[model samples]
Target: MIKHIVFWRLNDTAYGNNKQTNADILKEKILAMQPKIDGLIKIEAGFDFSGEKDSCDVVLYSEFTNKDALHRYQIHPDHLEIKKWLAEVR
Candidate 1:
């Protein structure tokens, strides 16, 4: 299996939302992708509550069946969609 993880530190304000709100939105959006993607064994995300300057606002973790599965996920339309949004906000 392949395990993938990501951490994001969002801008104070992005997409007309504050960092905390965006972090919650980002977690929900990422976690919602699990059932839609093939070969995705597991997926999860969480928002940071510590409010530390050095901490990332959100974290995403996913598991895939194989390397190919991971690669496919990286390019999958659903994944690509969120990636695009992250680029603008993170």
Candidate 2:
């Protein structure tokens, strides 16, 4: 299996939404991919509650059956849309 992890430290405000709200939206969009995309073994997203100064606002963990599956997931249209939104939000 292949493990893919991503961390994001969002700006205080972007695209008119606060960091927390944007994180929430991002989490929802990411989680929605599991059912649509094939070969995704597992996926999760969460906010940092560690109380660390350098903590990221959001983290995404994903497991894929293989590198090819991971590559396919990366280019998935839904994911692309989320990526665009995240880029603007951050």
Candidate 3:
């Protein structure tokens, strides 16, 4: 199995949305991809609540059958859209 992880620290105001708001949207969009992407064993995304100064605002954890599966997920349309939004927010 392959594990794919991503972390994002969003600006206080980005893409016309606050950090928490963008985190919520990101969680919704990322979690909704499980059914659409093949070889996706599991996936989860959420805002961090550690209250640590160095913690990221949002994190994505995913498991795939293999590298090829991970590659497929990377290029999937839904994921591509999310990537674009993330870039804008960054």
TM-score of each: 0.92, 0.94, 0.93
Question: Would you list the C-alpha lDDT of every candidate in the order shown?
Answer: 0.88, 0.91, 0.91
Model 1 compared with the native: what TM-score? 0.92
- Which scores greater on lDDT, model 1 or model 3? 3
* lDDT per residue as tens, model 3, 50-88: 979999989899999999999999999999999998887
Q: How far out, in Å, is residue 18 in model 2?
A: 1.1
- List ranges where model 3 is wrong by over 4 Å: none
lDDT (C-alpha) at residue 15 in model 2: 80
Task: Quote the lDDT for 77 in model 3.
Answer: 96
